[model samples]
Target: MDKRDWLILQMVYAEKNITKAAKRLYISQPTLTYRLQQIEKEFDIKLFYRGRRGVDFTEQGELLVKYAENMLKQQQDMEELLWNTGNEVRGTLRLSVSRTFAFYQLPQVLKAFNKRFPKVEFHVNTGVNIDVIQSIYKQDAHIGIVRGDHSWPSNKKTITEENITILSYNKIDLKDLPSMRRISYKTDPTLEMVIDNWWKENFSSPPISNMNVDNVEIAKRMVLNGLGYCIAPSIVLEKNDQLHKIFLCDTTGSPIVWKTRVLYREELLELAMVREFVHFIQDYH
Candidate 1:
């Protein structure tokens, strides 16, 4: 099968629904179905059957999926070899970055780098720190930019750090926090632990957070609207925002800081494109 055929088989098999696969491949449903029929016709075997829930692969289909996977893997390897053969640093550099970093800083970083090396392309995935780590471990991302400290067995560097702070529309007293409504946003385990530990150490009772949101941006907006106070990394704060900021600190009076770092496997540095991007990140900061 051709590369496109292999891709069609892989996407359809992975998604299990023709509609979803078609959307991912940027093709019409009719086109995807026609391509599948063509494949089955050439192989002279039924590949899959539509089911109530989704498409179910037949025995022959499963075997063909394996062959397609192997062929795609070999194709990827061949491309990597060819990319490194020439002096040009040109290839798709996969990156997994924290959603916060991706939102605030990554766009400018990419724009500047692309201006210099227009040949290189980026495939970026944004999520929490744990997701970024998992992406790197699974070899889905060549490098990861993650927030907070986590155990990674390979190469990493702390790019920046920011204080975790209590933000509010008006001045707030620490003693009065338990009575006031607070906003809590879903965050990585590391930051959660940091905030929880700080609360327990400083106060006897729990925070009365009524609003639980999915992300820091939403929680920050709630605080801005005079809804409630929120504890978050100071990176979310804009210079013009008229919010009161109270920094979290250990009993030792040291500020509790959230760190952002870049993680990578040393072996990936063999690719000149990955290596250049990594260096660009260091110099960019």
Candidate 2:
């Protein structure tokens, strides 16, 4: 109900233990326990299932925790709006992004943003594109950068174009690719969409000989080490020249060019800091 309660809930959810959460919050264990009891009394639901490893959230607790976290974020955003109503650009900007973009594309953009608005602070986290979108939607993060088709929701904006290719070490021959293993996205719809349209025109089946990887970097590493071939953005080649391209996919005949994007909540569009960052990246090209 109050700010402290929201903070306590978030910490408890993150740490999954009352004692540890209390210690981290600089509060006594009994006090923390009492507060949690008060929350359960107020909400009329058990919030956690105690276990030897850690506390696990009940279904209701999981839902409430997400609500509480989002509410806290909104409160923080409101406070920031009031505090910086008429001043230099300043406020915390929590941005989520995929690992590939975080490592490959974001550093330059962040450096430029920081140089332009030195007062602004950031909380950045990296994961796969799906998790990044969930972070923005949950209000755990303010913005997200990800690769997708150009056809995004009305709220999303395309930031750049990416062409994915199946590449192997230059020294290796393409004739051996069918016999060798391959690395690819794990049931990834985005890549599967590409492969579907791509393979229909080129071959009868998708690259079934390959193994699915969790991420792009691991695939690139495997390809670099000659473990297998991988399908990745052309930027990977630009970033690591030594990997050497064996072939470029002729995706011109297919609708498979991956569009990288910057997405934020539609409701936050009017916020000056948010708009500035969005427009900054939108205008980058």
lDDT of 2 at 283: 79
Off by over 4 Å in 2: 13-16, 20-71, 150-152, 171-176, 185-187, 205-212, 238-240, 246-256
Every model's TM-score: 0.94, 0.75
Candidate 2 TM-score, C-alpha based: 0.75
**For model 2, how does the per-residue alpha-carbon lDDT over 203-269 read when each residue is reduced to its tens digit?**
5444555467776777787778777777677756664457755333564644345678898877776
lDDT of 1 by residue, 76-177 (tens): 878987999999989888899999989888998999999999999989999988899999998888899999989999999888889999999999898999
Regions of candidate 1 where Cα sits further than 4 Å from its true position: none
- Candidate 2, residue 183: the lDDT equals 80
Model 1 lDDT-worst window of ten: 72-81
Q: By how many angstroms RMSD does model 1 differ from the true structure?
A: 1.6
lDDT for 275 in candidate 1 is: 87
